[model samples]
Target: MKLISTSNYEKLSQQAGEEIISRIKRNPTLNLGLATGSTPTGLYQELIKDHKQHKTSYKEINTFNLDEYIGISKKDRNSYHYFMCEHLFEHIDIPLDQTHIPDGTAKDLDEECSRYEQFINEHGGIDLQILGIGQNGHIGFNEPGTPFDSRTHIIDLAESTRKANSRFFESLDDVPKQAITMGIASIMDSKEIFLLVSGASKAKALATLMNGDVREDFPASALKNHGNVTIFADKDATALL
Candidate 1:
């Protein structure tokens, strides 16, 4: 595991974006695992800027999002599908058909999870996976207590997770109670992982991750077992370190 800290969130985003751009330049056909939420918004913005200024093309790139809220349609503003389109996909040159996100409204969610796992394998696994640690140390909605060996599956969003996401919804009650997320095992399959942590709210979680305790109780800690994991955190997020 490698840690890189910056003075503020903007610099952290720039550093993370530059790393992603470098990887893309090395392999234009890179399979990227993406994350949603406020933490990654800045990073996505930086990527968009690079796309506009440097013409860093994603035309040959393949992207797979980390998770999506259950019961939400792709058109729903709150859906991860819409989030990705608004934040990254629509702005990039990548073909829409090559960008994959779990169908949160699939009639048979179990089959969907299985298919998503298979789809990822068919693509030769993700080359790089982007992640954001939750205040409670959850990664890609794989909340605390989630088995480290689990695969792509549905999860009941933790109360704290839902409450934190409430800001994006009209009201707390409007937040989805469940989601389909790439399991810890699925995430670990990535050749490399980039974890972006920002804000003082995540300081405790960042501290816990850096402590090197590989316990399932703290899902993010599972990354310690991965050979190539880089953390780009802002000073506020690493203050407790």
Candidate 2:
């Protein structure tokens, strides 16, 4: 529940990226968890810059993305897989084979969900997890009512989430109805967590998650129980808080 605000998004992004780089340097083979959203776009850009400057190397790191829209192809512009490659994976030195993103087109989603969580456990769980809060306080697509102890699973997107995410879609109708995401338990298992938020649009959710009660109605509130968590936000995002 710790909060750190910066004068602007760029500096916040850089600081957060530096912290991640330090962790990776401490352990070249760190198991990292990733989140995708407009909030983290700047952070990814800074990481790209770090790689170009030779300040960071992702050669042996392993990444597990938090969620993916179900029923979408990896080639889809709005897919998390596509977004990750466009923003960070493509610019970094991490091998594609070392990254793990949930399959959006799996025929048996239940099996896919089970396997995804199992794979995480086998890989030593996530050492660091990056998260972005939805407008309604959802994290990793685990919208309100998602049990705090749950693991990976399929879920319907809340209306607030759909509206917030629709900016990347042709229309609200084009947004997928469902997604597969790591649950609250899975996220809490991470040794460290970094929650990034930027922009005025996220101010309300950021405020709520930071000061609100620990309840399922605000899914991100569940994060308070984690022993090591850092929340980084730009002024705009921290305005409400």
Per TM-score, the best of the predicted structures is 1
Q: When superposed on Cα atoms, how far off is each prediction in RMSD?
A: 0.7, 1.0
> Residue 56, candidate 1: how far off, in angstroms?
0.9
Listed in order, each prediction's TM-score against the native is 0.99, 0.97
Strongest candidate by lDDT = 1
Clash-forming residue pairs, model 2: none
Q: What value does the lDDT take at residue 91 in candidate 1?
A: 95
Per residue, candidate 1 scores C-alpha lDDT tens digits across 39-101 of 999999999999999999999999999999999999999999999999999998999999999
What TM-score does prediction 2 earn? 0.97
Each candidate's number of clashing pairs is: 0, 0
Give lDDT for model 1: 0.96
